[model samples]
Target: MIRVNHRSGGVLVLAVTETRLTAAVAPQFKQLVLDQIEAGNTRLVLDLSEVGFIDSTGLGAMVGILKRVGSRGDVAVCGLQPAAAQMFRLTRMDKVFRIYDDADAAVGALEQS
Candidate 1:
């Protein structure tokens, strides 16, 4: 579901390969993220460059992932497609998550902290 690249400075870049994140895949997505966190990745960058569609469940999964990180670390998102970006804005979740235009930039920001 996601390619977890463990970077330096405790930053993990998660690149989702799926184009659509709906109820069917949201659970799996959430699990994948949780698994990554449990594997010791706290600083995260969720790269949604390939995701073109996302439903409510997908949004929930994203929020769930953020919650999973908790006080231990943090999660950021990057490379949101136009549709996904609009959906996040509509849901006002854009304000809740740190966003970046590129994955490296997100990881850099997370690592710099």
Candidate 2:
């Protein structure tokens, strides 16, 4: 099961599970993010520490979420497991998103930036 945790640092941390985020769950994920944004909480940090894997749909969903947050707000990622991290690197999304070692570090950096 996939679970999303809205953290106190004002980051909507989506701690995914179940190995992969496919089309079946991408829309729901996107909607959750949109709901957060509409609630005036725009800063987001996807905590992929628990996600062992992610497919193209998952990556696309993340990109879509980032776009929704826009340049006006901060959207970051951190604590990616090895398999997921490899996928991010392979896709070169590592350059697209601000990835950190941990959630606290990401939140702090976002606050400063």
Candidate 3:
């Protein structure tokens, strides 16, 4: 479901491999990411380059993940496809999460934080 990569300065990059992030997989996706957060990976960059569709459930899952991190850490989103980007904008999640063009840029920003 996700390709996990550990970068320098304690940033965890989670690249979603699925094309659609909807009700069917949002729960599992949320659980997997929450597990990572519980495992001491607080800084995160969620790469959604492969995800072309995101429903309300998927957005909810992302919000849940961010809430899980809270003030203890940060979660940034990157590599959003056009549809996903539009969804984020329409939902105003663009303001809630830092959006980056790529994983490397997101990692750099989180590393600095």
Provide the overall lDDT of each model, using Cα atoms, as 2-decimal numbers: 0.92, 0.79, 0.96
Give the C-alpha miss distance for residue 30 in model 3, angstroms: 0.5
Per-residue lDDT value at 17 in model 2: 59
Candidate 3, residues 38-112: lDDT per residue as tens digits? Answer: 999999999999999999999999999999999999999999999999999999999999999999999999999
> Which sections of candidate 2 miss by over 4 Å?
1-9
Per-model TM against the reference: 0.96, 0.85, 0.99
Rank all candidate structures by their lDDT, best first, as comma-separated numbers. 3, 1, 2
The collision pairs in model 1 are none
Model 1 misses residue 36 by how many Å? Answer: 1.1
CA-only RMSD, every prediction: 0.8, 2.0, 0.5
Q: Pick the candidate with the highest lDDT.
A: 3
**Root-mean-square deviation of Cα positions for candidate 2 versus the true structure, in angstroms:** 2.0
Q: Pairing residues by index, what is the TM-score of model 3?
A: 0.99
lDDT of 1 by residue, 1-113 (tens): 88878888879899999999899899999998898889888899999999999999999999999988988998899999999999999999999999999998998899887
Kindly report the root-mean-square deviation of model 1 from the true structure over all alpha carbons. Answer: 0.8
Give a tens-digit lDDT track for model 2, residues 10-86: 66666565566677777887787778788887887777776777889989989988888887688889888888889
Residue 32, candidate 1: C-alpha displacement in angstroms: 0.9
Kindly give the stretch of ten consecutive residues in candidate 1 with the minimal lDDT sum. 1-10
